[model samples]
Target: MRKLSMAVLVLFLLTSFGIAEAAGSYWQRMAHGYPNQLVVYEYVYEYVSPELEITARVPQLAGASDVNWQDEFNASIRQEVQDLVASLQEAALESLELEQVFQAFPYVGIMDFEVKLNRGGLLSLAIVTYTFTGGAHGMTYYDYINVDLTTGRRLAFTDLFDTEAEIARAAQVINEKIAQEPEWYFIDQFTPGLIAADQGFFLTESQAVICFGLYELAPYAAGIQEFPVSAP
Candidate 1:
């Protein structure tokens, strides 16, 4: 366990310094009245062994007007990466045991992030993780980090919608959308639970994308269901 901790620490140290297999990209978005372009780097970490492999990629921004936003976003993502590595380490132990007993496939964990939206004075990043521990197939999960470019405030459902009426209205929209394709979703999962204060979402030019994970509202075949709500 101590050795594993040391390895995770080393992984963090390496990724914190713009150390990615591939160099970062450039993003041009709207900020105030002018064009805003920021450099995007992949904060990557990797651990490979006989029993398991883990790779993490979080997008880090540079050249933003708000330095505080950049620092806070970086810190929060680093913590998330740390927690994921620890969780994967624990899962890998069980996977190793299962592999020896059942002769199953080795474990694999991967996390990557991308710029999902950058408009309307808001920036949304999508982070996804996939893990396979001797299963029929791997499971994928998602987390989104959204920020207000003007105030550098982290935005949530509450921040986007001001009142319960707005929330209910949004849910109604989602419900209607789901009804349009009832065969592809689970009513019980998305009915009353459609809108939450901290739901995964991203902004676009005209609407906000509300996200659902695999099997949350439908079968894995449906993939992650993203419903668009007219941006508020």
Candidate 2:
């Protein structure tokens, strides 16, 4: 099979959400030649054959507040796509015997992203990818990318909290939500030590939404266990 050029890849997906042009809205910018409003264009890569199928939908950004940050972020996404391709390819090869036994089709792999929050001087995104190599179900992964527009710095969960106590309180809020439906989650696996300072999280106007991977704290039906806690 042949690989598609960047121009052809861009033709696959390109969209922009309306921005009110509000004052100090970092996510609202003239990106990718958009005179107004923030723009997000997806860079797609697909490879298909009788034995394997892999695709990655990476978000491409341009004309951000900081050129340096934009370059690094875009490069990072590309690298992630490359790594996924390589890893999935290896897994497909390793599972060749299992594939034949199960009479399965090509090993499938997919990667995509979502703009969870994009405003109020913060740009939060969720990168999601899935892979299935001869199994009853495919596995999913999540990566949260939060950017501080004013400084072009990557923000972590701790960065949003004023003090350690606030972070602990945020954890408490998440635990309380889990308590409501305790059976849906692996409550025992969720301990205080599990609250890593740089865990996956996105942001809203008033809440810092926590992110968890598939089967990390719950089953696949539970989806992503996101808890929104108060934060600036």
Candidate 3:
């Protein structure tokens, strides 16, 4: 009976040590980096001095000749555009990649906002536009800002003047090229079976990386990374 009890105690101690060792190893990986981990695309923004500012102007009431009218219109427009710029800056700082800014700024008043895409002689742009939904004369003017993502520089200064059309065009071009080839292409290609099992899925390469990333990190995430593996 003493021998039997001794055996039971030894088994319990061994099991407890194994569990503790596993938990310690997991925490160590969490503190450091994962081994044999998949490479994920993370945007490396190069900070530069401000250059251009994009403003959205809302038409004023009564007369365009009134200096106060122009001032008010300009003020309103500047406020709105500044708000947009703030939100965009926040998103850029927080995002893992440039493609994330699309979902981040759905309500930003940029019109005809689209990633310029070219396929077999066909050019396409996802133009997003913002219109005043209500109010006197329907709209007002706000501050403007422009981003040169290629250089990681921004301009909201008067010296950096650019037409709305030009700003939209530049953003679209950047978005399109970024969508086609992200930093995660090689990583995703190496582990295609885990992320892109179906070729029919209309996912951009960047999106595929994100999808796979959520999958790999979900176990440690607080349910925010619960992604659909198979769509209905």
The RMSD of every model to the true structure, in order and in angstroms, is 13.5, 11.7, 24.7
lDDT string for model 3 (137-224, tens) is 2222211222221121222311111345433443344344434554423232222223222211111112111222222322223221
Q: Give all candidates' CA lDDT scores.
A: 0.70, 0.71, 0.30
> Which parts of model 2 have CA positions greater than 4 angstroms off?
1-38, 97-103, 188-192
Off by over 4 Å in 1: 1-34, 66-69, 97-104, 188-193
Among these predictions, the greatest TM-score belongs to 2
For residue 92, give model 3's deviation from the true position in Å: 2.1
Measured with C-alpha atoms, the lDDT of residue 187 in candidate 1 is: 79
Which model is ahead, 1 or 3, in terms of TM-score? 1
- Which 10-residue span in candidate 3 carries the lowest summed lDDT? 200-209
Instruction: Report the lDDT tens digits of candidate 2 across residue range 1-232.
Output: 1356765555443222222233323322312123323456799999986667888898977667667877888898999988888887777777775546324467788999998666554577888988877658888888888876546678877666547677678778878888888899987435556887678888665567887877878899999888887643
Better of 2 and 3 by lDDT: 2
Q: Could you tell which candidate, 1 or 2, scores higher by lDDT?
A: 2
TM-score of 3: 0.20
